[model samples]
Target: MPFEHYKEVDLSSRNTLGLPSVSQYLGAFHSVSDLQHAFEFARNLSLPCFVMGGGSNILLPEYLPGLALLSSDRSIDIMGDEVTVGAGASWDNLVAETLKNGLFGLENLSSIPGTAGAAPIQNIGAYGVELARFVVSVEALDLQNGLAVTLTVDDCQFEYRDSLFKRHPERFVVTRLTLKLSTRFAPILAYQDLQRLPAQITESAEGLRRAIQSIRAKKLPDYRVFGNVGSFFKNPTLMKSVIQTLEQAQVLNSNTRSAQGKVSAAALIQAAELGDLSVGQAGISPKHHLVLENRGGATLTDVLTLAHLIQEKVERRFGVTLEIEPQQLTQLIHAPNPKG
Candidate 1:
């Protein structure tokens, strides 16, 4: 299809967080050629461009000033145990498809929202399995020259909830991803809840995926039901010495402490007594302390206000600064950063 651009597009329902926004110019691209053309269009107009996928990991302002591009290329190809997926492909669908084909590497990552391109950007993790472990390479468009390039896993610089794409948001527009899956059943049950699963469940790929889906369903609010972008804060991984100091001071609760010296951000927020905390219509999710929710008709400012309050309280109570997890359109918006 020819490249099409629209003006004054409403994006309230586009984002999982449900923040209302109106883009100055918006384009949806279905192929690599269309993607490059969109970038060129933005450049020719001297307008700043923002590329979005799935709209699951971003907070948009009331009115965006430039071009907004959405990836709509949803396609997947499986070669033996290796799967090369389009950036716009649903992440959960990829997991489901792989498992149905007897693949095992993605079971622990089941039920995650967003697209394949976003997976490596955030190094998305759950139930102890991270996307970084299975990624072979990422294909992206370098907007500088409107050229397509392939990036190796090492080149992506994956870290805890961060990557090279995140650090340099303007440089790469992820178009496709190639992941190396496995036919062998190798389950990772290191996370606390996953460890509690029965041997019958843990022994199989589909069984483990179901167990994780059940666990997440109980702990996290579905974006469809409640306006949210999943976890709002990254779990803080600290030095053992720092954890010991907090423990001695009786500041770190038992539930927050992990064997690897990481503390749950949710536990810290709860410790600060910020559960059910709200600003305007934005509030913390009662189901999971880590999530910030929009009760209804919430603004971007309201969400930021609530997030600031949480950070202030957690820092005051535990002396740890909580970092935000999602990418945002505004300057004040907190993009995912390394855990403190």
Candidate 2:
């Protein structure tokens, strides 16, 4: 069956930042067949395909004149300690479901937004746990050749906030994720926030999940209220010599370190005193320096302006460049041709 496609789809409500945007064409990939059908449509029209996840980690432009795809293959199957989930499956839902079924590893990543397929791309980590540690393999379609292939953890080349998929956005689409979880509850409470929790909160798998969720709730803005994409910048990881250089320059603290002993991006922004900075409706989140909030009625330019300001100020002060965590539409996909 041919895939059904739509045109001029409104995407303002699709992204977490609530930027007003529109896609020239839109479709869903229910299965591999659907994927081929959608690509055929785009191929015939000479339009590039852009995949949209839960809309949690993307920045959309005002108009996208190509095909915008959303994965709808929300399939989940559990066999022993291995769990397989479709690309469209909600990440939080997967975490909750696995925990309910006695799987214990994803408890630390409790409330992360976006889909399961998007998890491996970023090697999403939180509370001392990384998705790469649990990922058995990633079932993806190599768009460059239109073939399905399963990528091993090594093939993924997992790094802090980056992976092969992330590096080459147009090459592959994650169709499914296979994770090897554990029945035994091994709680990881090494993060600074988790460290503050009492013993009871960290005693059980569920307890740790709820505690982490609560902590995130207090720090992160409700997208419904103030649109945001969690942390907007990745923490900067540097070599020991770089750290010493920064410390000597007074741009970094000798003690304030983040995961993998990297300097915290949030700390750098806070030290730059960018909390009160804003461009129109876009502002630096006072609650968390790493988050850039879209106060309703904000445009993409507003957000970009504010982000640029933060980057400029932080870099001016710390001599460290803060990399944007979320993928921008322009960066992720080929520019859509208005002529088409």
Stretches off by above 4 angstroms in model 2 are 241-255, 334-340
Q: Put down candidate 2 lDDT per residue, 299-320, tens digits, no spaces.
A: 9899988888888887787678
Q: Could you give candidate 1's per-residue lDDT for residues 60-87 as a string of tens digits?
A: 8999988887778778898998899988
How far is 37's C-alpha from truth in model 1 (Å)?
1.0
TM-score of each: 0.93, 0.94
On TM-score, the leading prediction is: 2
Query: Which candidate has the top score in lDDT?
Result: 2
- Model 1 Cα RMSD, 1 decimal: 4.3
What RMSD does each model have against the real structure?
Answer: 4.3, 2.9
Let me know the TM-score candidate 1 reaches against the reference structure.
0.93
lDDT of all the models against the reference? 0.84, 0.86
